[model samples]
Target: MNLDPPISSSEVTLERLDPLSAAAARPVTTGAALLALVLPPLTLLSRGHEVTQPLWLIVSYAALGGAAWLLLDRSRSTRPVWTAPSAQVFQVLLMVMLVTAAAATAGANDLVRDDWAPLVVGVLLVASTPYRPAREILFWTIVHTLLCAALGVIQAPSAITDVPALTLAVTGSFSIAVMGFAAAAYARSLTSSTQLWHDRAWQSAAAAALEHRSGVARSVQQRRVSLLNREVVPYLQRVVNADGIGDDDREEARRLARSIRTLLVSDVEKTWAQLMLDDLVGRHPRLNITAVADDPDDLGRRAVLERRTLLRALAAISVERLSATGLALRLSTPEGRLAVRWEVATPRPLPDAHRELRSMLELIRGLTLRSSVHELPGRLVIEFEYGY
Candidate 1:
C-alpha cells in the first residue's frame, strides 16, 4: 500500500569533516608560521647590540617553529589525521626550541622578557589545537610554562632583578597560559558540541532505519496474507471438512503456490537503487527524508559505487550545517563522464552555504559548478560532471 516513498542516508562528523579538519586551518597555521619567522629577527633588530647570539637564537627558535608548521600542515592534507605520536614529537620540538633560545641568550637580554621564543611558541600551540586534543595541548602548555619559569629562575640569580625568581616565573610564561589555555578551551567546546550532534543524529537515524525495515517486512507479509485469503486458505479448509481431495483441488493448490513464488521472485529482482531508497527512507528522524526514485531510465549498480562515500559525506554535512529539510542526489553518465545533481532543501536560505562547503568542494572540484544561491529561496542545486 505504501509504494510512494523510498529512503536515503547521509553521514558527517565535525572532527573529520572538511569543515573543521586540520587541513582546513592551513591559513591559520601559515600565519603563525610567518609570525615565527618575523618575531625573532625583529627582537635582534630592535635590541640592536643588547641581544646576544642573534644568529644562534633566531636560527634555532624561528627555524624549528617554521619547520614544525610546514610538517604539521602537510601531514593534515596527506593523511586522514595528524597522528598523536607526530603531534607529541612536534610539541617536544617546540619546548626544545624555547630552551635553545634561552641558552643562546647568555643572560644579555631577560630570557623571559626579551626572548621571541615564548610568544611565538604560544602561537604555535594555538595552531596545533586543530591537530592535537585539548588535554594534550594543555599538558604541553604546562610543560612549556614550567620550562620558561626554570629558564627565567636560572637567569634571575646571576642578574640584577627586583622581582623574585618565582614572580619572574609567573610573568615570563603567563602569555603561554593565556594563549594555550584559550585555544584548548576552544577545541574542547567545539569537540563536545560536535560529538553531541554526531551522537544524537546517528541514534535518531539508526532508529528510523530499523523502523523502515520492519515496516517493509510487515507490508510484504500483509500482501502474502491477502493473496492466500482469496482462494488458498479457504480451499484448504473445505478440503479438510470434506472426505478426500479431488484433482481440481490439487490443480488449484499448485497454481496458488506458483503465483506466490513468482511474486517473491519479482520482489527479489529489484534494482540496487530501489533497495537503497527503501532502506534509507525515513532514516533521518529529524526531517524524515522520504525518497522517491525518478529513475525511469534505470541502470543501478550503485550508479558509480565508488562515489557512495562522497555522497554520504556531503549529505551528512548538509544536514548538520545547513539545517537541510531534505537531500536528493542523481547519478548519471553524460558525455562518457558521471554527471551528479545534488540538491539540498532548507526551510530558509543559507547565504554562506558555499563558503561553509569550501573544503568539501575542493575535495570534489570536478563536481562543482556555479549555481543559484541568491535566486533560490529554499534550495541549493549543484549540477556537475565528475570524471574522477
Candidate 2:
C-alpha cells in the first residue's frame, strides 16, 4: 500500500470503510433480515394492542438493519475500510436497540413475555457485533455516550418512585447515567488509539520523504564519482604524458601526476563531506554544533569531527548503487579517550541470510557499548565514563 497522509475528519464515513464494514455490517443486515421472525411472535403476544403495533415495529427494526447493511456493504473496499462517520451511525443504532429492549422489558407484565424475544436478540446483536461498526470504533464510542445521554433523559420521569410525575424514569435514568460514564471512558480510549495511528502515519511519511532525498543524493554523488574516475583522472594522466618525454622529464612528470592525484583525492573527499553534512542537516535541522559546544572540550570536539568524517565516508561509499540503503560508521577519538559509536539501519528483523550484516552491526554495538556508547536504528549516543 502507498503511504498517504492520514485519515482526516472529512473522510470518516461508512463509505470509506467498505469491505470489512460488511463483516460488522452483516450482523445489522441479518438482524433486519430476521426481523420477519420477530414481528409475528411479537404481534401474537401483544394480542391486538392497536392494529399495526408489533407488526410495524418489528418490520421497522428489520428494515432499518437490512437497509443499513446493504448500503454499507456496497461501499466496501475503501483504503481504511471503516471511517469515523460510519461508526457514529452504528453507535446510534446500538443505543436504539438497547433502549428498546429495556423499554419492552420494563413494560411487560410477565417476566418471560414472548415480546421480549426480539429484545433478547437485539441485546445479543449489541453485545456481539460492535459498539461501533468499523474503523469508526472510537467515533461510534462517542455517539454511544450521546445515546446514553438520550436514554438518561428518556428515563428521567422514573427518578422519583413515589412521585406520580416520575414513574418509568427512576431506575433506568440512573442505569443510563452509569452506562453513559462507561461510554465516555470508551470514547477516550478510541480517541487515544486514533491519535496514535495518525502519529504513526505522519512518522512513516517523514521516513519515506527522507528515504527519497537520500536516494536522489546518492545518485548525484555516484555520477560525480564516475566523472572523477573515468574522465578527470584520465585527462590528468594525458597531461602528465604530454609534458614527460626524456628520462629526467618523465620522472618529474610521474611525481607531478602523483601529487595531482593526491590533490584530486582530497578534493573529492571534501565534496563527499559536504554532501553528507547537507543530508544530515536535512534529516535533523535542530542539530546545533555551535550551541552544543562553546569552548571545546577535547572529547566533544573529537566526537563532532568523527561524526563528520564518517558521514563523508558514507557519502563516498554510496557511489555503489545497491549498498546505499543506510550506513553506519564506528569512530573513536584520536587519543582513544572516548567510547566508540556507530549509526546503522537495515531491513529490520535482520535476515539470517545476511549473517555478515548481522555480525557487523552486533559487533559494532557490543564494542561501542563496552566503551559506553549506545547505537540503534533511529539514534546513536556515546558517553565517556565507561565503567558506570
User: Candidate 1 regions off by >4 Å?
Assistant: 1-14, 17-24, 70-76, 160-163, 214-388
After superposition on all CA atoms, how large is the RMSD of candidate 2?
18.5
**lDDT per residue as tens, model 2, 108-176:** 212222333233333323332222332333344444444444544453453322333232333233333
Lowest summed lDDT over 10 consecutive residues: which window, candidate 2? 288-297
Tens-place lDDT per residue, model 1, 174-287, is 888788889778777666676677558667766775686688778667778888897778888998998998998889889988998987885677544555554444355556
Q: Candidate 1 at residue 164, lDDT? A: 82
User: CA lDDT of each candidate?
Assistant: 0.63, 0.39
Which stretches of candidate 2 lie above 4 Å from their native place?
A: 1-52, 67-167, 170-181, 193-216, 239-388
| Per-prediction TM-score | 0.55, 0.35
